[model samples]
Target: MRRASGSGAVAVAAVLGDGARYEAGRTQQTVRAGQRITVSGHGCTVRQICAYRVVLEPAAEPDKAAAAAAPSSPRPVGGEADGGFCFTTNPTVLATASKGFPPRGDTLSVLDNGGVRRFPAGLSITVSYVDTRTRTARLRGDCAAVAVADYDNARVGDTVEFAGVLFTVSGLTERAIRLKRTST
Candidate 1:
């Protein structure tokens, strides 16, 4: 089946890696990873702008054959990332790091796999705390940052170094912070 207009996972892959960019008409653009660039679409040509940011949606890779896999459910709209990145209907979701922030004062939250993944990359925030396994971050620390990054980016089960933190996402209408884990 054909996807709406020109939206396809392959089209997203067509612009993979940094330095590669594509403009899809006047409403859409694709920019590769690891580079600050904007892929904007004109009437028929997509323009690449320097020093701008582009975000790519992540497609879920199935663990088994498509026929064997269960039909997936729709992700929550405007939700945050807990297990992984969230999918957004709007493609302009991304965050740019303003500076290398210290983990101190850093805030964290979990997205229940609804709206997006890794906060879309262009969000900004203040460092509340950081460790190899977990990040302690506050929502108000940065607004755009909350919208751009995800804690599931956290990696666990490392013998030595780890970054993914243990936390829960709260405050749906406002800033959500880490709910302290009560000892059993």
Candidate 2:
């Protein structure tokens, strides 16, 4: 195991003693399995993260304790796709309406049984009845045509690109699109 000792604000990470892996911010991957690691920098903290698995571990036989405890077929869900931030498929989204519209910051929720545990962002859908004679190029979509625009197509994970606002999708509904507050 190898270790780097530092006392400063910058992040300085390293292995513990022998056969440990430390590559900057990517991951403290150690060649030695079950080797403990210690990270020291700015706010030095220790979090015991599950070792990354290369192959899926399988479930053990119901009758055999040893087999049940040690199976190599599956691993935990959510890999590099989840990035780092934890999220839920039915993440509650909240959005505020523009002036004269419904109160903003309304919350919405969706049910996904597919273990869909990902909430990217929400979008604010504005519906307006366009005059057939008048052509609004910018405000031209199936959503802006009817008096009551339905957000049926809006689903979780779909990027809601707006002219002025950026949001992470939380949930979606026929009448509303769930959005979480975020930067521009």
Candidate 3:
């Protein structure tokens, strides 16, 4: 994978099964597991995403001849042509209050995913009160309560909207909850 010049988007080289190589183009699309993308008109579902490589599975039968005969020109898909990264589309982690921390403030590790995950310093919810037992959290942005997670008890795969951004609860643990941003 290579970063596009001046854009910072990731560009990958797609190699077909028949040894045909082509540039998959630069995409700023925040893809998640199970999302579909088209490479040179061949549909593929994103299987797994790592820091360097994105694994894709064939979503439909490929037009082998078409892919092989196509030019090596870059084709943009999924993301906008504009530059700059969009943080709202990626997965985010939120930490729950542990044994003895007060329900307020924004500096504790246990209350902020061990300080490993944050909302980019000034965007989205800045402070949250999470209940590990109930698996819920009261998210606050700029001292105003913006969202809560008690409507459905914050189970895995549950979705919550915080500060106008929709996110799916992709993972949950005693320490943190993983939220993946969704188009909806």
**lDDT winner:** 3
TM-score on alpha carbons, each prediction: 0.17, 0.20, 0.27
Model 3, span 85-137: residue lDDT tens: 11122122112111112232222222333322223212223214445666554
lDDT of 2: 0.25
lDDT of 1 at 78: 30
**Runs in model 3 lying further than 4 Å from the true structure:** 1-121, 143-153
Q: Best TM-score goes to which candidate?
A: 3
lDDT per residue as tens, model 2, 73-116: 22213333221111111112111212112223443332322111
Ranking by TM-score: 3, 2, 1
lDDT of each: 0.24, 0.25, 0.35
Query: What is candidate 1's local distance difference test score?
Result: 0.24
**Candidate 3, 150: how far from true, in Å?**
10
lDDT of 1 by residue, 3-122 (tens): 111111123312322211243433332443443433221111222222211233222233112212222332322334311212222222211111222243343343321322232222
Name the TM-score of candidate 2.
Answer: 0.20
